[model samples]
Target chain A: MTGSASGLESPAEDLLKVQDLLVHFPVKVPLIQRLISREKVVVHAVDGVSFSLKRGEILGLVGESGCGKTTVGRTIVRLLEPTSGRIIFEGRDISHLSQSKLRPLRRRMQIIFQDPHASLNPAMTIGRAIGHPLQIHGIVRDAEEVRQSVLDIMREVGLTPEDQLFDKYPGDLSGGQKQRAVIARAMILEPRLLVVDEGVAMLDMSVRAKVLELILNLKRRHGLTYLFITHDLATAKFLCDRIAIMYLGRVVELGPAASIYAEPKHPYTQALLQVIPTPDPDKRRKKILPRGEVPDAIHPPAGCRFHPRCQSVLPTCGWEGRDFIDLLDEHLSTSPKGVEDDELLGSIGEWWAEGFEAGRKTDAKDPKKLVERVKEILAKAPPAMAQAVQSVEAKGEFVIVQFRTPDKLVHTAVADRTVECLLYQ
Target chain B: MKAKHSDPKRASSLPEIPLPFLGRLIHPLIRERRSLAGALSWMGLGILFFFIFIAVFAPLLVPFSQTQPFASPVLQAPSLQHLMGTDNVGRDVLSRVIWGARTSLEIMAIGVLIALAVGFPVGLLSGYVGGKIDRLLVLIMDSIYAFPGLLLAALIAAVIGRGVFNIGIAITVIYIPLYFRVTRSQTLSVREEPYVEAARALGAKSHTVMFSYIAHSAIIAIPVIFSLSSADAILTAAGLSYLGLGLEVDTPGDWGRDLSDAQSFIGVGIWWMSVFPGLMIVILTVGLSFLGEGLNDIINPILRKERS
Candidate 1:
């Protein structure tokens, strides 16, 4: 009964393949302001991310908030349109398909949201909420049949006293009951692929384990494949078959669940795994904490986005002129007495940085004096940054500081696994 | 734990005011809000039901036929024989005012129904589709909304010409934008709720999502608006008739037209002709408004949830 419907298709084939999917949101500006500036800004979310899921596989997309894991799941289900890239589901490219064309495909895939209170309509009774999807997809026509099927699903999701809870609204139920009802709504149609987006994140800790167990039981019973999105690595370890670590909208590392936990290749993945507390008192773990906050996606750091905070950074780590500008700004703000000229101090923000070169026009009396002064400033940089700074020279009235450019880290094989870092390369 | 337990005792030292049984009966209404809107609503409903009774049994209750001319001495003052006295045409003023209830209620109820019928679907489409069609319909509704209700009613009345049905149409036009604005805005917000999105994600057709999820949830506030709009409808219809733009001069029953005819007699001290008709208008409108306010008390969960 479980595999009879989809047995003809090869089990070894990929169920869903995503290639370089990008979902960028264009920042809206006032009409007059936009016309005068002629500049278009966009939030680079879910930039150049790719992954594939096989049938019966539960792939976890784990990352911090705003890492675009949720966006990736939404794009796969066609909830949010992708700005670019292909999403091949069951060998069909559904990347840019129209809503009408996607309607039939929606029956095969479903999404369970995090907040169960918000996911179900407040005005609708629990019975109607669960059974409505069945009626909509033409799986059941009669109201009584719909009710019986909904009750069956409710029982399957561990919601008992089905008769007592049938006519109750979402407001009447507890947090766990609400979530169980939400799961019943998603599973009533028996979709092939379910995208669970932090589905247990909002439930109580006591109820979390039970709901997770229920999800696993349902997956096995129905032979359902899942693309589980969560920030909790512990839950992902318990649930996901394969884990992909996302950093600034890119899959920095991906492999089997056990291997990622035992030996994380990417610095970002290692930092995440290190934070999990172990119960053993004798073993003191050396925690690798990344510096600073996740940078704004609008102006992501040049080269590798994690390079600015990477503990194992190399001399060629994707540092651009902006890095120099940031360093200069920090120096000026901390100790301002070194620079006396008001004009030069006021014009420091006018410095331009791109690629590996950063420069600013100076109003100095002599070019040689400005060159000497710029070199003195570069000398005060930390040892790592000082080594990366190749040269400082004054050309006419412009002082240019250049840094050695490192190669961008593509997905490189690390033994049996894959990682995106200069160290792995 | 001991300090927390003593806090309630300290707060309870202030004496509590004892409420009467009637006060306790309506306690839910005033417990959280501290508003007179609830009290006024009950008063208004009482006035409205009184007129509904008058209108329903106008013939049986009246001493004389409202349409019969010279049934009594013209300019007769209030007496046992004539409770509200006679009009300028010698017809019974009390009977005419009683019969006027039927006319006013008909225009108010039917006109609001017409407005809701026309405005709801248009608002749904304008809000749901939401681009060029939305912009165009919004522009048209805003133009109508810009005018004062009576002035708009007059303008529409002049074009459509006057009679019972025409006056109803005029009032309908005046209030259509109110319904459209309310329903459209409600639909706009309800369309964004996760439940509506959940329905769409389940492969529900556009119509199914619109009717089942969006419309069902969005229209909760509509009934609250409906009662209030009907009250406004009564005032607008009366205004149109007061300007001689409603029923004909010899019409048997009309508050606005009667008020118009009674104005000439106001200079002569024949107060019953004007006062009776004007008083009925006030009572009926007030009744409708109170009914609306009362419904608001029950329908709004935000107000009800806090106390319960």
Candidate 2:
């Protein structure tokens, strides 16, 4: 762990370390539901995610929605309790600390939420909202000192006319002003680690850059360590010193921002980079687009979770009967000239990976010709899919396609990075 | 996160620009939900103050002792000597009615204060630290709430024995469930709000989060509930007294007991006995209801904003 922390001769030292954090939320069911369903269902929101933050470093956790990037940020600040993990902050394990025990440590770590509108109490005035931490933590004993400090911090956050805005409620402020107030409140305690969960995603385009700049300025001023969670790659590139690209509740790639942008290692990271629409239309950048939607976290792909959608997928990248069906469907959707009315096509939706036997009631005059046409179509498929197909035969008017059992791709070290693909493994 | 249609320049100026304290208090009354709040404030304040004044200065107005009877005619009608006439025992009916204000106020004050004291903290705990404790509290409160309030008060009063303190205790029992339910429900929602999470993130302990973040927001409904519950308490106390579960029969100036005594005199055309006590109960309850509704309009910003 110490060797990993000192990987590079960086000036700053490690401030926070998180190891193999898993947060699963049990789906609440009534007693009758529990009795009827023998198995307990849990949403694996964050599964085995781990990363560390260096002092004065901005580590962006970037992923698509439901990738559990936000959960990683929240769990670090102890906002959301991890099911099991080692969250060593300043060399102390505070992962499973009680609420009372966590209270004092809360002053050292803070979290700013995405929606400024929903982040401040509507009932409390701006002054009280910002000063509440000071009062609660006994940081400032005098009310006058708290007010003066609140006004000073308010000005620092660019909320001018602090005296006038002091008594105003959250509903009274605009989006940008509300965010500034929120930032002021979060920073007044001078927290060392800040978990910003999509903090600027709710602000308008005009104010986004200014807010981002303000964040950078604050980081420089206070030497703050940030776990910045966001889905926008562009913003993450601008603000994050280092970026961790997450996929299906795991960090697939973690490196410096410059290196990642220059040459992204993971397939998922490469696909995410391609998503940013280039302004220069003349330069047609070759995009490596993932094939389908993200797999469900509850039942993630057996090998690399990104394997189902990965364009750089190998034969051993968890390819199963469903993968074969997807390829068949894709081939048919594009050409479907011969098997346009196949009944089995619609029935593929109900089939799971565990071996299934279904017969198509076809009135085709030449079953041999149909099988030849399907074979011809299969020959044109991608090499990975083409190789996976073991058998394609016409058995009594039914065209059967059997795929080889896919070997699970295990994670292996490629250079300094961890890559979960057979090509690298 | 869509920018509202309102200009940014103006929206920034909307909340923080301070108005004078007096103006801030009066502004909502003038503009937001004007007609209803204004009418209620005037009527309710008028009646409420009238009762409060009577409660404070009952002795100054009453010519004779409230509990003891006078040497005047047993069933005297309205006259210059005995204003509003006299009861069947020759006691000045007006004196007892005036003094009834003090007794009614005592019940309202004791019942609400005790109910709030017991209900508020319990509700706050049940909501803020929800789990087995919350389930247990909800079960207990619901069980208590399931019984008809008046009947429960009567049952409690029967066990506690007939006295002013017993009456207040019985009324408190009925009102506690009301406060607990309201506070718990309000706390449940407030606890989930991001602001509460923000407070927790700011190093606030459990008690601080409960009282400062959750309770502070949840307490807005309290003034409304307090006024409304006072009205409820008045009726429940009167009902208990009328059912012989409240103050002793010999205790004079109790509106419920007075009403019970007035039943025999109604046949003899002694309308003053029933009319004054009944009107006092009606006026006080109406006053409290109006005050409660008026405070709600002022306190609930959503309702105030809708009207504006």
Which candidate has the highest DockQ of all?
2
DockQ (Cα-based) for each candidate: 0.38, 0.49
lDDT of 1 by residue, A37-134 (tens): 97678888889998899999999999999988988988898988999999988778899998888887888889988888878877677888999988
List, residue by residue over A186-240, the lDDT tens digit for candidate 2: 9999998899999999888889898999999999998888989999999999999
Report clash pairs, candidate 2: none
In candidate 1 the C-alpha lDDT for residue B269 amounts to: 87
CA deviation > 4 Å runs, candidate 2? A1-12, A280-292, A321-350, A355-383, A389-423, B1-30, B63-66, B249-252, B293-308
Using lDDT as the measure, the top candidate is 1
TM-score of chain A of 2: 0.84
Model 2 has an lDDT value of 0.80
TM-score of chain B of each: 0.83, 0.87
